[model samples]
Target: MPSRFRAWELCALMLAVGSAFTSNFAGADEKAEGDIPAFVGKDSPVGAWEYGKERGEFWKYRNEKPTATIDASSVGKYADKLTPGQIALFKAKPGYRMEIYPAHRVCGVPDFVAANSEQNKTLAKLDASEEHVVDGVTPGVMFPQPKTGAQAIYNYLLRYRGVGTSVSAQVTAVSPRPGSDEWITAVGPSLNYYPWAVEGHNKVVGGGAILNGISFTYVSPAALAGQGGAGKIYFNQDAEAYYYFTGQRRVRRMPSYLYDAPQLGYENEYLVDETGVFLGPPIDRFNWKLVGKKELYVPYSSFGMYRFNAKFDSVFSKSFVNPEFRRYEPHRVYVVEATLKPDARHVAHKKVFYLDEDTWIPVLAEDYDAQGNLWKVKEAYPIPVWELGGTCDFLAFTQYDMATGRYVSDQTTIGQGKDVRWFAKATEPWMKSDYFTSQALQSRSDR
Candidate 1:
């Protein structure tokens, strides 16, 4: 089961990173940045100033390691701004289901067609009585509100899927296309247990425990290939923690593996790259900045699910790992771009993230190449709602290589539900460092 129980919250107090009591946090005004406390006397192995140390488990895993610590208090500070409904939703025990659908009906105008002599002559003289108007209007002109990548997904979850304040299931099925795998099914137990799985490389690679309706899994790229492998992860249910039997090595949740750095506006954490590689150590560091927001059209948005899913072989090759080959300056968020300090470690070229500010979620990301060219583009959209409140971060995404016209998309499916206790009990024998090796994955059952 993927642990999505606000893991940052649990670790917040220890690292003093996400404490709501702190002043400098997300959504806070820029002026407040100056008033933030510095990392002077904290016992963090990775001080705020020395965030991106090039040594430690984090370094070995991420290769570059984190250059700075993230401010833990920031989580609480920003979380406070959430509406009561949003807060309740975030804290809800019921799992959530997310889905994505591609809408066909491209641009058109029914009224325009009806008034156009050319269109009426063609239709009236032909046996196309089966054709309908645009949204009930004659000639069927489409409304301008093109279903955006995120909105297309959100609407399906809220409307067709029956996702709301209560539990429900929704259809997330899509026709199997030519390029990618076919659509899969998922069900949640009591709106809390959500099952999201991914079939990659002609193999079932990503899926995990759906305990008490909430769990998360980060399948390794190796597993995505249907190869015998796993990924490192963080998960919780019913107040207990369980480390997944997979992921890149060197991930940990202990104080020794943790660091604090108020100076960086971050605390109590290590950093990892897209491949599940950790980027920082107990002694690494980097500088943090909250760049302004921007709207963007990311590639592989849900709108193209139907057409793109069928074009898999044409887009990706077995050797493709970010074949898009992008880079960045500071940091790389899935969708939201954040700039990093020049001296930062483990980060690609300077980058920008197209994150959904409303959900603090990312949808599309762009990476620069060594030459600072727009080498790669990664796009993701939310899945439909069946469980887990029907609202999720992203259902799937595709990374594209503009130079070679090659790409790879990771589509996902939710899984069956389970009890929260299942996760709590599972956590009893787990350790943060256990995920760093292949032997650790083999020993999960015994643990």
Candidate 2:
């Protein structure tokens, strides 16, 4: 996913005279254009981009309302197999469809087991040591109990939608640590969707080359909401490229903003290893479970009843990720789970995620401790804006300690406005690495 700040920096430079962002494709399906409303940009805050009211309205206008009712009993005939009810649901949503088949029987393989063979052998040797060791008389901190094997069930399903690669993430606690406030930030070349933090100068910086090596950026402030100047932000790549915002309004022009739908991985299994590095290969080896469909009120995006209880694993019956003895409620999205290759660097033993079906967005995630307990829970959401084509322009994501109250949430893409020319020519010369490096920032001193 393009960095939120990088997109903002590019959006700032493309200042067109009028409010309407011109169509990228001439004769671009008037139907597609018609599907979206006109000139909603001027009335919106500059940096608000994650899908919001404007895009939501377009979705509502273009697509027919789905019949919200479903026959529960008939859902089973297609539980492991595609049934007629499942087909009906898919037909109701535009640009959407469903692929239902036997969970483990598809490739003529036996059902995928969450807590069977290999996983136990691998997890058996982990140090079942204490959660934490404290100084002097204070008792050592006890981390949350390890996750039950159920998370493996969750991963087996979510992997089907993602590139199934090792995504990058960082957990941050407040300055003092273990307080009421915290944050978390996760980024990939193709997507950036996280939860908003209530307060703080939670900032994150990251970017890479676009078409022709034009680099990008992302940033946020300590406190959001009503704060006046804290969120001040901008992007500059020489005279040909200038993108910045005075408070909320944008001023400048440059190409290489987001909305380009850049690819993050080379193939389904390879993380795009060019400018940005993939931690590892695609997460393809797994036993999967397609739990039919259901309705879930996830963080940012909401859709009609869709697939539910999707789960998966790394290789075969091994379950070393979320551990086998942890107890979690059924309603909690703890079922969606995955494990990095045992040897992959910076990976949690098992990571369980609660995902939104429509957008393939992860609302919450559970990172496991060495002993397989719920180490941290990560949350994410985006700010809605029009100039960004009615998508989230800002994103805030946080990770909290499940046992202790410590946590951290990084905020990125927090600014406003747009330059039409820069947006249209997104993916250009100025957005390269030399323009945004530390040497560049240190050499020039003016905003």
Candidate 3:
């Protein structure tokens, strides 16, 4: 096994322009794209050129959805082998079909578990809505043995991801037109700071209500370039989000920015809470129910999605991300179903999430409309962040608009020369608290 790679420094910046990225293929020794060496995890089964494994004629299906028929005759044999959402997806007949791979263990953070053990000597309960953690919150998994759906989701959402992560470049793409080989892409840099998620520290640092603070600046698509802002994910309340508009030259609070709000770019393909499947506050408008566990083919060890040297043409298909570059392992996942409350409102009336049992990171999520029709399906690619003591994180994810066949993919280093920088400690200047405020957001805008 390869040794864990060290965290990259913040100085290894990617130029704000999309043209600054390179698309040429790389060899086995394609290390150190900039000041810091790129990482593919210690236990990853591939080299720098994971894209070399793509099959011949795979590109032939670019203009169409999955050609294979999936019905009672085809799905009968595997009916019991997959989740209801996965089954529903099969019926939807996507361009890419499911491919199951061998299961493996995804590493977890040691200090996080240690801190979780120390801080949660007495586990706490959720608030009246059973969404927010009322007490006993710490850096690691919020609920080790979660009996409720809310607790399981809390475990998935609050898992320690080092102090935070500094993304060098995450490219988001909305699927292109049929027979037209063009993609609408966005390039950006993101900073996430966990106020109380610092490792080796058992107690909360900042207010626990504010779990994480994140800021983003996009540098591509000229119209929105140099625009950025910051926000905080609260424990019980809606997030506090602010955006600094380069055109306006001012910072404005996004009062209604949380949940189902379409992102600024991507032609309404990306939503505010769609990233990572669910970045919304826990105590929002859903009533969560523990749906037990199931063995499903979930994305795991997705080194192909992290191919900083691979071209976007190799991964971004018309309807969905190229299935050849995606890997699915058969593992037990904690299934949770969330439904809109009696008086609640949102675009998605129902949401179901499949979280990896070991790492607690959600691998697949399905959203339903008010009439119980499958609306959107999302999948996240998990790669071990070896620098953070072999802990796991999802830097690549995609959401498919089931209705229009349009899809939005993001948090990827694919085709970019640099990779997302993971930090085991909060040492960067941007990871501080004040930087996430609206005032700091205005001063920090790239304009």
Candidate 4:
């Protein structure tokens, strides 16, 4: 219905309008760039990428992209020799240095753990399918020479921690404001039970259910007294949690308490799964990649941090735990990166875990936000439990929230004397399965 010239004019106008709209859209994106925090060091690669991508930027470096690997010829005497990319990934400051020492393979499991691991390995090899089954494996390290990242994670999950351990430990969660040494501290006692670690009980018990259990009851600051909870981890599924409110006098089941859930009175920075660096199975929520081996300055053999005479105030320093009592040693660690799946929901978009090769215990972890900014750094200090035939255990650990400057320290037995104790073997009556029951929790609280 229109002339050729008129049609041409209309097309020109439409193109002009489209160009203007695109220019405006691009301008808006440029303006929004300011909202993103300035990228530091090698983080510029991540700034250009959008958050919540199906495959995160860290996954790009999963395989051969990261050419650096720890070996006998590599530099290992000092942390200063670490690559800039490595330091940047850990969010360590420019001047930060870690004193490296000779690698020691001091991790030793009990006879039971060694025997069980051998059996588990055989069972695992028989299955050719990719389907991950919980019941097929026994206790101890599931896969000693783990080829995939998921297998390495499973090894950590099943690492030898003795058969049923009972530990009385204290948690010191400190929230400090800027320009003040004053820190609000929440001190409390916690009890841990590892039902799966029970000796002579290799098969599944209690109607073929329940794996591990923990109960924590705060006994300090008056306001938080008698306010704590208990949680049970299943063999194949997520954990079931319950919180005790002193006022209500009832234990309410909290199914939503798994993964990224905040610990009470800890400023919501420390997550349930973030405890012990990486807790529970991460197979479903994340795509794990084994970044290979690297010599790292990780907290190891830090028995001094658990001294009975050490005072909490002396050990607690501004911004971080005191380095005097903390010991760092050079150890070959398997670097594993866990990027959140697109369907998974969590505050931490990416997590980098450093696991000791000898023990398979996570020694250091870096957590990143959705915006790809480093949010928190966690360190676990390992101490060899001599009574358990040199079995290495996490003596104490700290999680630092970089943005908020708040931190949480758990498993601290320092200065608690008789109130806190770590035993290689569980105490006689407490080792019973009935001791971890929900009914038992209510009855114990009543007493």
Highest-lDDT candidate: 3
Query: What is the full ranking by TM-score, best candidate first?
Result: 3, 4, 1, 2
lDDT of 2 by residue, 1-447 (tens): 122224342234233212222221111121212112221221233234333223333322223332222234344443432222223323332222222111100000001111111122232221222111111100000111123332232222211111111112211113222332222222211121111110111111212211122222223232321111101012111112333333443434433222111222111111111111111112222222223223232233221100011122210012111111111111112234555445444324655555332222344455665677665555444222233333222133434445443433332211121111112112434333354333343233133
TM-score of each: 0.33, 0.32, 0.80, 0.75
Q: Rank all candidate structures by their lDDT, best first, as comma-separated numbers.
A: 3, 4, 1, 2
Q: Give the winner by TM-score: 2 or 4.
A: 4
Instruction: Report how far off residue 138 is in candidate 4 (Å).
Output: 3.3
Candidate No. with top TM-score: 3
Ten residues in a row with the worst lDDT in model 2?
102-111
* Runs off by more than 4 Å, candidate 1: 1-227, 231-272, 275-288, 297-336, 345-347, 411-440, 443-447
C-alpha lDDT (0 to 100) for residue 3 of candidate 3: 17
C-alpha lDDT of residue 63 in model 2: 39
lDDT of 4: 0.59
* Of candidates 3 and 1, the better by TM-score: 3
